[model samples]
Target: MLSGVSHTLRGLLDDLQAAANLRPGQMVVVGASSSEVQGQRIGTATSLAVGEAIVDTVLAWATELGLTVAFQCCEHLNRALVVSRSTAVARNLEEVSAVPVPGAGGAVAATAYFRLEDACLVRAVQADAGIDIGDTFIGMHLKPVVVPVRGRTRELGAAHVTMARTRPPLIGGARAVYDVETARQRLQGV
Candidate 1:
């Protein structure tokens, strides 16, 4: 189980980096459900312990890569995100009130809220990249022009994983000579 967690984390990092070209100080939104990852229904078997373990692993990796992370709450919070207050201000996001709980926000978001430094809830964020574990629907938080990312592991436990990155909208359709290398690089999982 631990090995599977590690592998999933590694693959997620690779896919995120490749898809978004996430640079230092960038924000990425994560929507997760530990229960789903542990082969349970999305919110049925919420586990703070599992959520903590996943958060610890992800935060370590994100810190090393110089990326900021925002954990998305479940539908109860209208899918609001939990992030550091600093990140909220930096990104010009609207801060909201309320702390996450397992029932209202899901265990994953609740765990993030507890772990983050000076955490705050935000109504929305135009995140540079996003990972959706168990199909929590993170598209609303991502920047425009969401491009899907296919990683080595399609599912983490029972949860299906999905990723997306934004790109500049291409105009002048037929005659446009897009940056082939950049497009290819993103598709190649860099």
Candidate 2:
């Protein structure tokens, strides 16, 4: 049987997908602290099992949608992220040298690092959407224009989950008429 946290995470993923309306090539960054999920201090307790479960669920969903998933490292590593090599190339993110481990990168990031296919540590990323679990501070990785996503489920396990999705910046503030049709057309397949 899956754990309660695992079930909660799956629901969170579904909510994110629906609310974010992410396109196939878009990205979602996740910053999770397993210790907090277990109701402990951020890095005081690391659970490989919880980390692996969350990573697996996110990867499955992202792969199904043809989307990228980035895992943010703990503050010990300056919050660099683990992203696929392709993501680094496509997003023009700087690759950093580091293999995330439990102590340095927290359980979620370390597990993601080891399990991700063709993964690399990147200096930063501007993701289309994000989830910050246990106040891990994922906002730094999201795009400039962010809209908060409030779902029926606000907490995942013992951690407080905050979600956000991004939109393209609106320009020509006053006199310009926003082209709603064009924007809808752009996201027609999402």
**What is the lDDT for 17 in model 2?**
85
Q: Pick the candidate with the highest lDDT.
A: 2
Per-residue error at 125 for model 2, in Å? 0.2
Per-prediction TM-score: 0.88, 0.91
Across residues 31-122, which tens digit of lDDT does each residue of candidate 2 receive? 99988887888899998888988899889888899989999999999999999898899888999999899989988888998888788999
TM-score of 2: 0.91
Task: Report model 1's TM-score to 2 decimal places.
Answer: 0.88
Lowest lDDT 10-residue stretch of candidate 1: 1-10
What is the Cα-based lDDT of residue 150 in candidate 2? 84
**Residue-by-residue lDDT tens digits, candidate 1, 1-190:** 7567767877777877887788898878899888888888788898787677677777887998999999999988999999999998888889988899988898888989988999999999888888888889999998888999888788877788998888878888875658989778878889
> What CA RMSD would you report for each candidate?
5.2, 4.3
Local distance difference test scores for all models: 0.85, 0.88
Among residues 3 or more apart in sequence or in different chains, the pairs in candidate 1 whose N, CA or C atoms overlap within 3 Å are: none
